[model samples]
Target: MHHILFFGDSLTAGYGLKNAKTESLPALVQQKIDADKLPYHVINGGLSGDTSAGGLFRLDYWLNRPIHVFVLELGINDIIRGISPQTTYKNLQAIIDQVKQKYPTVKLALMGMEIPAFVPGSFAAEFRTIFRKLADANQMAFVPFYLAGVAGKPHLNLPDMLHPSAEGYRIIADNVWPVLHGLL
Candidate 1:
């Protein structure tokens, strides 16, 4: 089976879920793939509270096997910690670079985050546009703001108002599936 790795932070990890294996985006995508009788094998390389730099550091370990698709969902944690957008961009770019070096033929997909245009500071704008910039530069399939219908919807999120609940994840998966399916 071809391997597709979903790598990122809390959202990818299914943070508040009782079971990531069955509820995470990767798992949900796997279910969709299975229903379609696809040969892709999904791998969840999600780590809670991880940042772009952290992902870069942990990348090599996950590179042990050949990967057909590599979906990157990191960076929000870095932004939450007030890291510079440029630094996060470079870090994510580095991760992309490493993955490309290891699996030259791997298809790439980037899951981006966005802040409202009204949010103050050049930081918000810069951070909001990083994924687009990266996607354009690298020719990766892009999920522009995967949290669209789920974010800020109280019922969609866990009590903490951060991570998505089980239903929220379903929505996320639906949002991601099309772009991901295209890569396959």
Candidate 2:
């Protein structure tokens, strides 16, 4: 079976849900893979409040496995912490580099995030474009804003409004599926 790793923060982890294994974006995607009879195993590598730098630190562990596809959904945490856009970019680049080095033929994908509306225009603009820049630089598949329609839609999120609810995860899974399917 092919392995597709979904690496990200709490949003990808299905935080606050009663059962992340069944309600998380990765799990939902796995369900789709099964339903469509696709030969792929979805691995959830998300952690609550994980930043790109944090992901870089732990990525080697995940790389120990045979990964055919890697979907990155990081950077938001870094942004939330007021990390420089340049720093976030470097960390994400390092993460991608490690994956490419380990699995030269791996199909890579980037799940983009948008900076909150109130952030400074320059910083917001820079932070927002990191994924596209990375995708273009690495020639990886890209999902522009996985939470597009669901973000800020209070009903779609948990009470914190920072993490997606089960319903929101379902929408994200649908958003990610088309690009992920194309990678196969």
Q: How well does each candidate superpose onto the true structure, as a TM-score?
A: 0.98, 0.97
In angstroms, the error of model 2 at 50 is: 0.8
Residues 99-181, candidate 1: write the lDDT tens digits.
99999999999999987677899999899999999999999999999798998899999999789989999999999999999
Q: Over the stretch 1-184, how does candidate 2's per-residue lDDT look in tens digits?
A: 9999999899888889999999999999999999999999999999999999999999999999999999999999998899999999999999999999999999999999996777767988898888899999999999989898889999999999888899988888888889999998
Candidate 2 TM-score, true structure as reference: 0.97
Candidate 2 whole-model C-alpha lDDT, 0 to 1:
0.92
Range of the 10 consecutive residues with the lowest summed lDDT in candidate 1? 112-121
Candidate that scores best on lDDT = 1
Where model 2 places Cα greater than 4 Å from the true spot, the runs are none
